[model samples]
Target: MAEENFETGDAGASQTFPQQCSSLRKNGYVCMKNRACKIVEMSTSKTGKHGHAKVHLVGIDLFSGKKHEDICPSTHNMLVPHVKRKDYLLVEIENDGSLSLMEDDGHLKTDLNCPNNELGKEIKDRYENGEVLTLTVMTAMDEEQVVGYKLDNK
Candidate 1:
């Protein structure tokens, strides 16, 4: 199959392709209402006497933890966002408190915003201590955020 390219805020980077609702499973990543969410539960009801069977999907926003649901016929298609987790090295902290990340391949990303969570606080602490750290970046639909971090033993 031909590969599809997705805009990852970069000029021309290839990402994931769309998928059908039936193809998604629990914990799968999907794009709903322009937000990236993780499926928490999924169910299918039997076909009614005069209608098609329905698929019920419940998901939580990956970044906001907000619950969202959608009900559609089994044959309906859904946008499965191309979710990517990339590791970046913390190279600098900008004046505005944003982060400067360097990809494994040495590409610099300067506009990354740190999440407001416990993990985000820990990452900031490590950075202040002059310790090397690796950040896990989650990107979908051209939007990117730091989801996790770890000490860089290297």
Candidate 2:
């Protein structure tokens, strides 16, 4: 018998949990090479003389947009990360680069930094032009980043 360790994704304290490699589905979250990623593709191989069937997975980082791949036995367990996304109205972009965001529930968050990417530049540009912006932020594995923005239909 093998000793297995698992963490429950409770209250955001823990960000990942263990699941059998074969049970994973495409587009689900997985930990690849120590980075939390979104599975983009998956494949399986037949059982071999060495052990159980093998599973191949390719994933992209939810935060940094990096690619990672891993192979594991179907019967073995792998860590799957829990990902969450939220949208907030842009209140202000501090000179220090932190974003002051307001939630729909009237909560204010000022800890997230404005990313130094194209999206970040766009956010600042639009805000300076007096446009209301809704930013999408994704959180996982104790990390958070701006992923995208929502377009106003009105």
RMSD, one per candidate, in order: 4.9, 6.5
Give me the displacement of residue 58 in model 1, in angstroms: 0.6
Clashes of each: 0, 0
Q: All candidates' lDDT scores?
A: 0.83, 0.90
lDDT of 2 at 139: 90
Candidate 1 all-Cα RMSD? 4.9
Tens digit of per-residue lDDT, candidate 2, span 39-93: 9999999999997999999999888889999999999999998789999988999
Clashing residue pairs, candidate 1? none
Location of the lowest summed lDDT over 10 successive residues in candidate 2: 4-13
Candidate no. 1 TM-score: 0.83
Score candidate 2 by TM-score against the native: 0.86
lDDT of 1 by residue, 33-74 (tens): 767889999999999886778889999997788999989787
